[model samples]
Target: MLNKKVLSCAFEKTINIEWHKGQFTTNNFLHILIHELGHIFYFYDWETFKINHIFYLKQFLGHKINNLNKFSELDKEKVLKIFANSNYGLSDDDELLAEGFAYWLLTKQSMQTKIWEFWNEYFTSYLPQIRDKERKEV
Candidate 1:
């Protein structure tokens, strides 16, 4: 069985500590892990090792990089910069695909703690703004 305390502690170590406090349950952690794992599985299918490796290299070299398990608000800013400069914002196709895949994976299982609900809300708010910039660039 999953431990709510341990899961909440892990969440606290990340960016959403205060905001997500008392918000996440054990089931929430399972959903998050499964969501991330979905992204990993998708990348494998999409032959994204090249770009993913580059991303990891930049991360290891101390560049501000955000992967599924490790996204901070700063990474969100970087994505905004990418949206300002490129069609996809700062997110590459792989990242976008991963996000979608995560949502899909969440649907394949029972969701607890309303984590999927929060994720959907976040995507609904952010994706359009990013996409609006892309549309204007066209």
Candidate 2:
């Protein structure tokens, strides 16, 4: 059976805005929306993502010093910046990707940082292909 998932957002209530430092601004809403879209994007091609990206990300953050050692200094710095952008992302690889995606789309500083290169690559290369495939199916 195909499973269905729901993503709910209540913009009117203060409770929904609390996690965003208690402000209900358009920027905050955009961040939340983009972050959730990132999750949807991940789930859309989960098998490919799990094999290509998640495995390496898990190893880099996992409990082994040797795994961390395998990454270059630049790569490590980029990963740290991703976590720094949103501490919530530290919970897991999926959050990391979502947070990175939000930061890449919403923050001006993100353009200068290599931290969001993965998102750039995905958007420029994979997104068009995904769109084209959907168009053909329809």
Candidate 3:
């Protein structure tokens, strides 16, 4: 062991230093990975993906998004800008499905619990393929 203390951690493409303190967590990373795999599932199942997308799009656009995550304060203006500006999610059917899948996986929602149920069932049926795809993609 050296005299100097450990300064940072790196996991795959994500680097964590003092600057990124509290910005994310292990659960968040898994959620994001799950989100991307959700996109792949959407590609395989277009009809169900479309239905979920339209439903969530209406739900989110109809009201202000208040509790999307834990790290940020809620604000309609900022959230809308983020929805419009993000590279993925919030702007299209596929992205919406992916984000919704991740949200459901991460947070156990009681209301409209069907979304989580659907993914859970879907993943159960396709576990091996899902794990393989996620490993390759990330």
Q: Residue 5's C-alpha lDDT in candidate 3?
A: 24
Residue-level error in angstroms, candidate 1, position 6: 1.8
Q: Flag regions of model 3 displaced more than 4 Å.
A: 1-27, 47-87, 109-138
For model 3, state the Cα shift of residue 23 in Å: 13
**Model 2 lDDT, full chain set:** 0.56
- Per-residue alpha-carbon lDDT of candidate 1 for residues 1-114, written as tens digits (9 for 90 to 100): 758787667675662552254322223565556546746754553362233422332343233233623666565445433312212212454444444445544564564334
Kindly list the per-residue Cα lDDT of model 2 for residues 12-35, writing each as its tens digit.
344355566522223365687788
Q: Which regions in candidate 2 have their CA more than 4 angstroms from the true location?
A: 1-9, 12-27, 47-52, 56-84, 109-111, 122-138
* TM-score per model over all chains: 0.32, 0.50, 0.36
Question: In model 2, where is the ten-residue run with the lowest total lDDT?
Answer: 1-10
Clashing pairs in 2: none
lDDT over C-alpha atoms for residue 78 of model 3: 46
Q: Rank the candidates by lDDT, best first.
A: 2, 3, 1
The ten-residue window of minimal lDDT in model 1 covers: 81-90
Strongest candidate by TM-score: 2
Q: List the residue pairs that clash in candidate 1.
A: 82-89, 82-90, 83-89, 83-90
Per-residue error (Å), model 2, residue 14: 5.0
